[model samples]
Structure formats: structure tokens, C-alpha cells
Target: MHDQARHGGAYIRIHVTKQGFDPLTQRLRWSDLEQVLDTGPFPDEGPTTDDPILDGVSYSFQVTAPGRTGRHIVYAVWRAGHADQNYYMCSDVRFPGGAPDPTTPPPSPPAPNDGCTAAYTPPGQWTGVSRAR
Candidate 1:
């Protein structure tokens, strides 16, 4: 999905299962990055809809799913900057290679972010939006 730079908002596109879809061997797993664009600070789900901002920086998304015969297939992508990593399922990952520059400054503080949320398990921590995905 493309953000298209409308209202400085991000876009997300998920692919549903189609015919001929088959399960792999190993269990599938993925890491949802809260930050994608190199810019800092993330916006909330519901914003004022004014003075919207969109940075090009992005984060990495790693997916490992079962392959045929219980094997495992790993997929990773450094894309989806405009997509804001707004995903809820594991799928194939396509990318060039390697992460972009690591020195890019983070986006500004999130003006608002109602579009994202997460739970903190033991040993992990949960916080408010502070970066972009």
C-alpha cells in the first residue's frame, strides 16, 4: 500500500489468503516495528488532521513462518515507510537488502496516535507512541 502523501497519513495493505494457499512447516513469526521512517516521533491513531507530517524513514519487519514439511521460511523487509507497518498478520517479505542509514534523525514526537497500541508481557515494557512505523 502507498501512503500517497494525503493528509500526511500512512496507508496499510494486507493480503488475504487466496486459493492454493498452503501452510509451511515451521511456525511463522514476525517483528512489528513501531518505527519505520527514519524520522523520529510517531503520530497517534487519531490526530487533529491538521499539520500532518510524513517522514520517509522506516523500520525493519522480520517474518518467519512454517514451510512445507514443517520447515521454516524467514522473510524480512525494510520497506513500508508510508505503510506505517500497519499490519496484523505474517506474510512474504520483499526488499532490496540491509537497512537504510542508521544516522537519520528520528521523527518528531507523535502529535497523536490512535492507530497503534501494544501490550507488555513479563520482562517487556509497554509505552506510548514515541516513534514512527
Candidate 2:
């Protein structure tokens, strides 16, 4: 998403609903909203028009789907800092497995010092884009 030179950053709010999104009526009301997934006050990473897949700054989040195997609609709202205008989008996703067990704890992480060395070299520096491998 493009920031369009907004000031502070952006706030990202994500909601999910089991109800299907109507293409003709591309608007959602508060009653149609279901679960609130993520709300982020993230840093400004500039425009993603420059190959977002290669080196775009982003925030990763995990969401809990409602059921085991069904389709769901995820709605994302982007509110720019110090701005009243907001951008909205809807995405359809299908789940293959049953719901996760909330009682089960997540797996442990790997050790910090696992005998790994770090080395990186940038391919080239563009006029306004910078990246590290």
C-alpha cells in the first residue's frame, strides 16, 4: 500500500466475517463485522510500488479462523496517521483444518547461538531504493 506522504505512519485494523462479501455491494456495516484480528500502529515504510515482494517492509500477524473447514472474508482497514480517510479491502480465504486448540502451548524457539554466521551483500543500489540480502 502507498503511504502518499502521510505523517506519522498508519493504523491497520483487520476484521473477519463468515458472511460472504457482495461484489455489487462493496460496503460493510458495523453489524456485519465479526472478529477483530489485528490493530497495528506501524512505522511508515514508504511506497510499496517498488517490488514489495523483494524488499518491502511489512508487519506479519496471525489470525484465528472461526471454523474448521469453510470460507471466510477478511476485511482490512488502513487509516493513515493524522488523517480521517481510510482504505478498505476484502479478501477470501479457505481453511482446510479444524480449529486450533487454545489450551496447547506453542512450540519452543531455537537457541540463540546455533553456530550460524551472518553475511550479506547488496546486489546494487538504485536511485531511491535500498535493500539487504
Candidate 3:
């Protein structure tokens, strides 16, 4: 998993493979992403194939919290085209006051949560739609 930050907030841009880069930090940033989701518990459950997904396309993702009262969570599952570079790793994501307990997820999305800054999900079960950059 990879990460990127913006708007004075911290978020993770998980990539199935290292593709993009952040010019400043000089790190492999996320890019060409297609879909993203919050997988934690109940409101933020996880590892379910039922989770919505984009097709075999190169996708980019990131997690961010713009203010102090913000909580954080793990933004997982990244797809990088049809190439299978499945390496496993994790991010040391932190939030407002202090880093949240790793055992628990920050919170569910739409709760002041920043959704995918990219992608276009059209009406009626958005299955095979491509978002413009």
C-alpha cells in the first residue's frame, strides 16, 4: 500500500503496484486509479468481494482528513491494470491528535470522509465506466 497527503490532511493512496510518484517527497505515489473504499467494521467492514470494484484497469487512490477533528482508516485494495505485481505492505497512517489505534478503523466514509477524488460512477449499477483524468 502507498500514501499521499493534501489539504493539510493525511490519507493513503494504496497501489497494487508502485506506479506514480510525488515530486516533493520523491516517493512512489498513487496514480491511474479506478476505485476506492473504506474497509474496517460494521459501518466500515472489510475483505468482502461484495465490495464494489472497477475492472482490470490501472487505478489510483488516497486517504485524507483536512481538519483536526478528523479520524482515519485503512484504504485498501488497489488495481494496476492487468499486470500482476502483488506485493504486500502497509502504511503508518496517522491523524489529528495522535495516530489512531491500529486495531480499529477511523470511521466510515461520507462521515466527513473524502471520497475518491477521481472516477465517474454512472447510474444503474456503475460497472464498466471509465473516469477522465
Q: What lDDT would each prediction earn against the true structure?
A: 0.32, 0.60, 0.33
lDDT of 3 by residue, 1-133 (tens): 2211111112223323222222223333445222234322111112233323521222233544344222323235432222432233444333446433457543433435466477766675568666768
Estimate candidate 3's alpha-carbon lDDT, on a 0 to 1 scale.
0.33
Q: Which ten residues in a row have the lowest lDDT in candidate 2?
A: 18-27
Q: Write model 1 residue lDDT over 1-133, tens digit each, in one string.
A: 1133322323332232222222221223233222222323323223223333753233332322222222122222223334544333344442333234347655545467678988656643446535556
Shift in Å, residue 75, candidate 2: 0.7
Compare candidates 1 and 2 on lDDT and give the better one: 2
| Regions more than 4 Å wrong, model 2 | 1-10, 19-29, 46-56, 97-133
Query: What TM-score number comes out for model 3?
Result: 0.21
Candidate 2: tens digits of C-alpha lDDT, residues 52-75: 445544445666655435445678
TM-score of 1: 0.18
Select the stronger candidate by TM-score from 2 and 3. Answer: 2
- The better-scoring model by TM-score among 1 and 2 is 2
Runs of candidate 1 exceeding 4 Å displacement? 1-9, 25-43, 47-133
TM-score of each: 0.18, 0.46, 0.21
Alpha carbon deviation, residue 52, candidate 3 (Å): 38
